[model samples]
Target: MNRWPLWAVLTPGEPARLERRVRAALMLEGDEEHGKGPSFEVIPGRGRYHAIVGADSSDVGAEFQIAKDLSREVDEPVYAIDRGNDPWAVTSWRKGVLEVLEVDPESLAESLGCLLPGRELPSDSSSKRPLRKVALVEGIRAQEASRALEDAGDPFPPGHYRFEDTPQGLRVSSETGDVGFADITLSERLPDVMAYGVIASPNLDMFFVNVLRGGECIGHFALPPRDDSFVPAVRDIKGENSPERILAALGIPAEWFRNE
Candidate 1:
């Protein structure tokens, strides 16, 4: 199994502010609402929900209990995350797999109260991994994506990127096209982007970019599972510069870029 880096975000009293910050960081575009659910927002985009969970020992049970209790109220299942840092780094999305749950250390500490033996959870805010030039490939299987780009050729196909896959589906992530274990199958609605599926397992899927255009995802339909068909259904050789521009515009976070 691939090791994932755990990340953290501050728990907010108001859900609205939390949501806004998540969208900005993750750059997600969805209409789903958190409402009164026990949800936390990630950075880049604000509309998505990446629930926090437990980090230390004995807290895991309590965190699961919290998720179970909140699941009844929220729209989806709750998750866990290590509460070691203020803005902790977590494997929220790895290509094909989607991280549905995260653990909240602070909440568990407060709930534990005097039960915990050590000093109250430390008050610290820092990043374990710096951001980098992360390319958000809408579709592409991780291994094949990596293989395709092994030597002289680009890692992704024409319009897709390497992604991670989990039992639930695709794990959300931002990494090199080859390293990520993403599902390759995708549904695109862009103008000149050509995306395709590389793997389709019972629980896991992989997809990648076959052709990209204008630096932007061929169209607004790059997210996923869209029903609409692309107009021309072809990739334009001239639009190769678009993906790079997108990365530059996104200002790849430190963590996404790998050293070698």
Candidate 2:
């Protein structure tokens, strides 16, 4: 039998009360004028509201899109929950980004119990999976990186480059940097030091200033693009003076950026 996937539209904030309300709303009072709308349930321990719209075997992509649309219309988060797969699954879309992840089925089932009281929970098979250093959920790491950067005092100027916290990682973009051509240089005097142009676009340009540490080429700070048509304010800034500020902004100790 083709396993049918479950769907829900979730609203943010305290979920427990919402779950109770959803349950109450779905219940019929002595078979009279109750149970008016769709039924919802709380995923145990998870902090989000859920409305259970059971099993649709239609196109998964379309289902996901519908969920996204609902999220936008209701101004709240929405999700597609499926237990057909090995690890179980939950998906959501936000800010033109789609996020999907395999989650613990037992935990998900426990949460679904309020709506699916007698249903069987899927078995757990993730014991052998290795732990990941970074979480798969979108924007978590980038937010951390951004906070680190901000606490360090916004070292990089806002004019030429923009640093974004993304699901993949920290994305650095240059507004006026050239993408086609890059300059890479190494210095014997500095030993194991290398600088390479990293990103360039119509509005941005940047370079990776890396220093070797423990046999690894660790990038310290990205240098802003330089052009001859510079204003006096920009011209006065020097490359040599950037490390402390950049490291500070990144919330890393100054000694960490130095060659050991």
Candidate 3:
């Protein structure tokens, strides 16, 4: 797994202010409501970008989590530099609602928590496998009804960026559009809306679905289940070689498959 470096910088702005914001986010400096998440600094050419440079930066999430809140509140675009020091993911929350979250594969495969603050990622976060660049999904607005982008985090797909909109759902492609494509959808809508994802690694690959209905999940489950190291079943939630229900739940549609 690609470990996160310490001292992430988030920005496209002045260094002093960015520093103060970073410090405050770590609870090491400021007292603003938007002062807590991870860290990253800006680099030229890659505007709205940040970078990290340490290994044991546990509070590393501070840069993103704290800045996310700020983005929502301030209705500005927040940037998080990948540990790879390439392009930072941009999360723009307009009026407390997500406008867009553009990420990269390196960020997702490295760690979903890298993009989503305070979320538990499997040990597979370190997997060296490549993820599908494009994913087709249903059960939510494609690009907030403008472009097709969602801030959903499930590893890979760069938060569903620059995707083409489909009538049934959204078609989120990768930043480069060269890797491959995967279809991800949510059928039930839990209560109102929910987003599902597929996590893939070289060794273990499975669908990571969070049946969020009014902000809660259904019973988590697993199939062909593992006696040891199994998740809560889907909420416990994990699967092995069996995901028919999951596929259906993911809104993959009955006709998409051949055998059924």
Candidate 4:
């Protein structure tokens, strides 16, 4: 999996300052809040520090969002290392203009490898995969959805969905149109459909399951943190009759939700 590298220049002896800036930029306060920020390491000879963030399995736009947010917070230039080329290119914004610098692959990998033990740099052969297509259907039973998805060679199991990386944003395509992540409206209001099913990303980390009945979204569940023991919660929620019962089964405190 590819990881985007974000780095900034550090003064000769200001490691503590760099740490503080990183914490602030990434909002890494606590485990429940930030989990773990990025993996940080100081370059062996260069005196500069780098933080690697955003997994390839995650949305590519998320990495760019981090870079953009950090760019506004720091005085020093923020570099985004692009690994698609044979020799990776480093991009930065200077004086409101973008600059690209190419570096040798072997040397760069050697330096990064030393800092990131057990991690391997992306290979030159790696290429962007094609956009995945999926069909969304209403009035389908779980068994029928599984059968149809299996016939179409979908990787995800029944009753699960995930957003896909797109140039526009995180999207999930349906027969009607594309639904962007920002456009997802979680409302108690129901639609007129009987049952709804969506084929989406196979990665559970990004997985979510939404159940709609009578044309209304009754349950919307995303994968919880590892410590939350999500599987049992999902099973319990599935057994519940109403949306309130499902929410109660989740064990999380209730909150007021607005209709979108």
Clashing residue pair totals per candidate (backbone < 3 A): 98, 10, 35, 5
Give per-residue lDDT, candidate 4, residue 127: 21
lDDT (tens digit, per residue) of candidate 1 on 142-187: 5643553443232234434434543322332433222221221122
Assess every candidate by TM-score.
0.21, 0.27, 0.36, 0.32
Can you give the lDDT of residue 44 in candidate 4? 35
What's the CA error at residue 63 for candidate 2, in Å? 3.4
lDDT of 2 by residue, 5-90 (tens): 33343434345554443334333222234533322234443434444443321111123434444456445445555432223346
Q: Pick the candidate with the highest lDDT.
A: 3
Poorest lDDT segment (10 consecutive residues) of candidate 3: 178-187
The sequence of per-residue lDDT tens digits that candidate 3 reaches over residues 1-260 is: 13434324343445466556555544444324556433333332233343333232233223434445555544345444323122333433343333224555345323422232222222545322232222345555554522221223323345534555556455444443321212212222223554333322222243233233332333233232322111123433224234555454333432322211
Off by over 4 Å in 4: 1-13, 32-45, 48-77, 82-90, 95-260
State how far residue 135 of model 1 sits from its true place (Å): 14
Per-residue lDDT of 104 in model 1: 42
Residue 38 shift from truth in candidate 2, angstroms: 10
Question: What are the RMSD figures for all models against the true structure?
Answer: 17.6, 21.2, 11.7, 14.9
